[model samples]
Target: MKVLVMKPQELHKLELLLPQDKIAKVIKKLGRQISEDYEDKDPILIGVLKGCVVFMADLVRSISVPIEMEFISASSYANGRTPEEKVDMSGGPEISIKGRHVLIVEGVVDSGRTVQTIIGQLRQKEPASIEIVTLLDKSKCRLVDIDIKYRGFDVGDDFVIGYGLDEAQKYRNLPFIGKVANE
Candidate 1:
């Protein structure tokens, strides 16, 4: 069997599906909303690393209000020993959330297991509130029900990549999200 690379048609299809400028515009609006909502409150932004670094950076720069940032890495997927499994916490940061508002920045919320674990663990720290902000939400893939406070995009199930998302660890630098084009 011969495997073909991406074609212009597939690229055009993806462009029609998701506009690059639109995505940026939505993110900027989300940032403004967060700033307005937390104008008087100082929230600790906990970025879920590896997956969310792209979204986190954009989100941090978008917010008008000052916010502190920390990282929390998790991977419940058992090292992909079983692709069907969910993500696990590789490890958490040393940031203190006690009595402080916490916002989790995430790239994708597929199974909801990663966020669930983070929330559960942070809840024990005595934080006043904990919320989530995800760039992409795939409702079809959610194994657990987790409420998201802010969302940039709610998209259908497709092996998406680019704009900080990678496939086989490549093409994350693409300006827009796209799938491996079938020829």
Candidate 2:
């Protein structure tokens, strides 16, 4: 099967949604905010594996303070595409977040279900602070209504991919964010 992204007369272009320069500016701005917030403290950034890898990498590099980075692999995808399934989290295979300032970096926030589950699991460690940071903030379909401390972008009701967001495990290498065109 093939995918049709755009039609000449569709009047909507993927390139218009998220510009490359804006994306860079937003990421750098967030990094500055984080640096100021933890100027005198050592912050531990926890990157949710797979999706958030690219965003986490960029954010960590931009941060101007000494910080530790860790990885946490967890999944909440259940059968099909229905969003009512309970997400299952995997205990981080390496490193411990106990008594650390944990900033969970994610690709995007849609329903907030998967991250919510992960946060619950990590709560047992009693970290000094647990905050959520996502590259894309979709408030239109947020089910849990969680406050994303560091949001790179606030988008509308559109399916977005690229810049670490993927359709089916692809398009993570695209420099700018794009949305699927609807017929």
Worst 10 residues of 2 by lDDT: 1-10
lDDT string, candidate 2, 1-183, tens digits: 223343345443354468678888888999999999988788888888777987888888889999998778765544323345576666562677778888888887778887888788778888888899899887887788577889988887687777887655656777778876654
For candidate 1, write residues 39-149 as lDDT tens digits.
978998998867677778888899999899989887554433122455556566577779888999887777788889899989989988888998888778788889999
Task: Output the lDDT of residue 26, model 2.
Answer: 85
Q: How accurate is candidate 1 locally (lDDT)?
A: 0.74
Model 1, residue 7: distance off in Å is 14
Q: Cα deviation of 96 in candidate 2 (Å)?
A: 2.5
In candidate 1, stretches whose alpha carbon ends up further than 4 angstroms from where it belongs are: 1-17, 76-83, 181-183
The best candidate by TM-score is 2
In model 1, where is the ten-residue run with the lowest total lDDT?
8-17
Those runs of model 2 whose alpha carbons end farther than 4 Å from true positions after fitting are: 1-16, 77-84, 91-93
| Model 2 pairs in collision | none
